[model samples]
Target chain A: MSQTVKKTFRCHPEPDECKGCGRCVSACPKKLLKLGSALNIMGVPYAEYSGEGCVGCGACFYTCPEPGAITIYEITPEA
Target chain B: MAEVVKFGRPKGFFETFERRPGSIKKNMSYCPGCGHGVLHKLIAEAMADFGIQDKTTFISPVGCSVFAYYYFDCFGLQVPHGRSAAAATGLTRANPDSIVIGYQGDGDLAAIGFNAFMQAANRGENYCVFFVNNAIYGMTGGQMAPTSLLGQKTATSPYGRNALTEGYPLKISEMVSQLESPVYVERVALTTPANIMKARKAVRKAIQINMEKKGFAFVEVLSGCPVNLKMKPADMDKFIDENMTKYFPLGVYKDVTAEREPVVRPVPTFEKADVEKALYRELPGGDQEHESCDSEIFNRELRIKIGGFGGQGVLSLGLIMAAMGKYRNLNVSWLPSYGPEMRGGTANCAVIVNKGPIGSPIVDSNCDLLVVLNRPSLDKYLPELGENGVLMYDSSTIKEVPAVKPGQKAIALNTGDIAEEFGNLKCANAVMLGAIGAMLTKHYLTPADAAKFQETAEAAIAECFAGKDKIVKMNIEACKLGFDKMQAAL
Candidate 1:
């Protein structure tokens, strides 16, 4: 028998690196990304995460054109 | 607790793009949602994962992706428009262990550099070529490219590309797969998530083949040009899937990678001696640069002009004189000017000998010695003689004797008559050379140099006709006869 483990997958989008093409918003399977209304340093709307429903499929990471615009993280909880 | 980065920038890319200009080097200069950025990311990932980043070299084409060197961590080379494939072939041949990748656009590869790319492919160069087909030319303000669809409208094709005029779109993957040399050929699109996954796989597979040293792998990527096509990011994908894919299908056209062996070409030699041998440089005499001259005439700058008909050997006579200067340990320059005809036309040459360095090979004016073989040459070049210049003429060809200036001396020799009497009429230039030797001994050269003039003339004749024993002997006899005749006349 295996014990249940809790894990957290985070989608981190760098606002300064993002060109706000909205590709990640469409690529997300959970529909948790949005083109933010507030402008970033680039003076354009940047992609934002809903901070809840990231499954870490890496669709957003692959869709974003900029090299370091988006990154996915996997965090495992301790027993 | 454990934390890991599931997806991030590949290590193949620089930690910071130092090659890129300006402060904000984190992002590429490509437009937002550009297909080149996506492809760059895929290639960077493949380069890192395959562990060929250090050994890999990327040839950037002349398009929007010309700045690929700014992003790649490994070696990067920028080639002229559409010449990346040719440059990649050289890089691969020079360094067989290194991986070469040629990045090109539709305008560059298909339109401008099609022949170079095709020849490299046919030769089975050990390199992977990534051909990006974005329907239209994206770099030069959306011009119509060879891969552009018939109905597609571009800057040059304003009225929507006509089937009668623009022709059908080129299926590069299909064309490349037809060639037997290419080991792998695939057409992948950057449209849907599934399609992008396929493209990612194709990119990795091509680079893998390069790592294995497979011969000629080609991947035609159906990319998007959102800004140039005036479409949004999401719509661009739909356009490529629906419209472009109809013309250029997305699939693997050929995959003989499993059956093919690694290519092994002969390594090129870079040794200095080997290179000099390959260039056909004479290896016997090392350096003949001498500082001092034994002759007084060689101590100052001496400009000699020899003019005649083409068949009179005027140029060869100038060469012999220049060779004499070379033997005397002086700097010499020979400049030959001739008409288009090989024979019967005018020919002239200037031989300049100097103790110091020669400023120019041209002897347009202020000639110290003028040797004319024909009447026309004598009449044309007489005025160019400087003060106290020696004017020598073949009296057999010229009827009238030219009047000499206050200090100048005019010497006449029956060069043609002497050449015929000696052996062959073609040796008239040799007779003239002997006469020139006799005149220098009497007037210009010192006693010690005068004694060596005959030996120098014989040596110059031997050098000019090297390996031709009969011609060397006959010309030396002809030179001695003309020398004896000139000494008696003087």
Candidate 2:
């Protein structure tokens, strides 16, 4: 039952549109999103993704209220 | 895991509502990451899930929820502040097919609209009521709401909410749950992701109850006021989690869905014939509408003020004019001052007869005619009359008739004397109405006997005293006497 599943995702945190509400970081079930040290234009700490273990749940996208805050893309393994 | 897929915006939202020209998607009126946006999305999704989108009627009143009309893709009504619940009852009762969703704020539902909310809930209205409790009055600035937390500082409560002075905060969800009619009642929050999920469930269940036709359902969403609370967007949830939740506990207050039978809404078809049948209390065509005697006067747009003491039927006179306007099928409005001096105090109202829809009902300044029953009212209101305005005074009470400018008419009627002659001093205002009728129709003798104008006026007056035979006859006699005097003077 030990299978190494290599799945990746891209969490696009649109910097300009994000209100830095951190809803994305809190909603990510995979714990891949973290608040980066850098600040967006609004001077709030923007969320950054680790690009690992996204699981493609879209929880971050679902919970975000700010438009264009997060977009997730699923990665497929090469056959 | 399933592939992560996302749509641009909810299909239930109007594209224009979600965005403006050259703007990003989700151009909501609410602030960034406000609770309203999340709630709006939840409601829209519920409408879609239940297949009630086509039949949904979103009712939003004043407060932050006022802009909900622009958000919901379905039919929306922006009603008077705090009237969402009241209007929801009417809409659901009449249509029966539509799913009425009433969205209200704490200031609206708990404060000014509390009566309507209670009445609607007590009657087990067939609708879903969403009450957004942000603690503070968000739309009108961070003012104290009925649900504002104790020791919470707001614009009005600079020293924080003093429990002794402002009284204990109202537990409205618990209070509303005490009512015996509602089938479901729940309190939820929307600050965190887990809370948002719970709120989504609560929102869905509220709508689900309506879709089941299981009677009234209320969902109180403990939302945040980031801008008003002056908290950062992300920290508002933390603030609510720490401060607001301590006072307003989130839970299901009542759920009797399994015990109650589904509501059977009686849909009465509204047609001209149906209204006529109900109005006449008989078959349609049994009665005839009042035919116009003087089309010019009847059709003219006129603003008339009737002023006197409270008990003197100053308000009633304006109402009679409004009734006449209805008979003529002209749009009309009667706005009463409802001043403090009720019985002995000065009371007045403005009655506007218009060809089209009325704008503001307030008539503090301009008036085409001033009919004053007492000297005090006459003196106070005469100077404010518009140019070329007609002045009609009660000669029985007013000793001196004020001089009017050229091109203006002054009619003095001994209304008290005429009403006393008819064996009722209470009918003085009725007499004034008759004089006004005579002035307009140009007929004064036995105006009640005339089959056209005078009889029409009498019929309109009789409506005011529908059940009381004594008052109706006395008012008719008083009107005839006043009409004769005015006709003779002319």
Clashes found in each candidate (C-alpha, N, C closer than 3 A)? 0, 0
lDDT of 2: 0.78
TM-score of each: 0.72, 0.63
True contacts kept of 2: 0.21
Q: Give DockQ for candidates 1 onward, in order.
A: 0.70, 0.25
Residue pairs whose backbone atoms clash in candidate 2: none
Top candidate when judged by lDDT against the true structure: 1
**iRMS for model 2?**
4.0
Q: On residues A3-71, what C-alpha lDDT tens digit does candidate 2 reach at each position?
A: 576666667776655666666777777778887888776676777888666666666765777534566
Task: Give lDDT tens digits, candidate 2, residues B1-490.
Answer: 4544342346567755542434444456667667887788778767876777889999878987676767678998989988888789889988887899998898999999999999999999999898889889998889999988888899999999998899977888898899999989999988767888888898888898888889999999988778898987568888888888898899999999899898896668789888755643421221345434345444556788988988999998888878766665566788999677657888999998786667877766667889999988888888768777788889999988687778677888888888888788988998887787667656322333244546656666778778888877777788788877877776
Most accurate candidate by DockQ: 1
- Kindly list the per-residue Cα lDDT of model 1 for residues B351-386, writing each as its tens digit: 998877788999878899999999888888889898
Q: CAPRI band of model 2?
A: acceptable
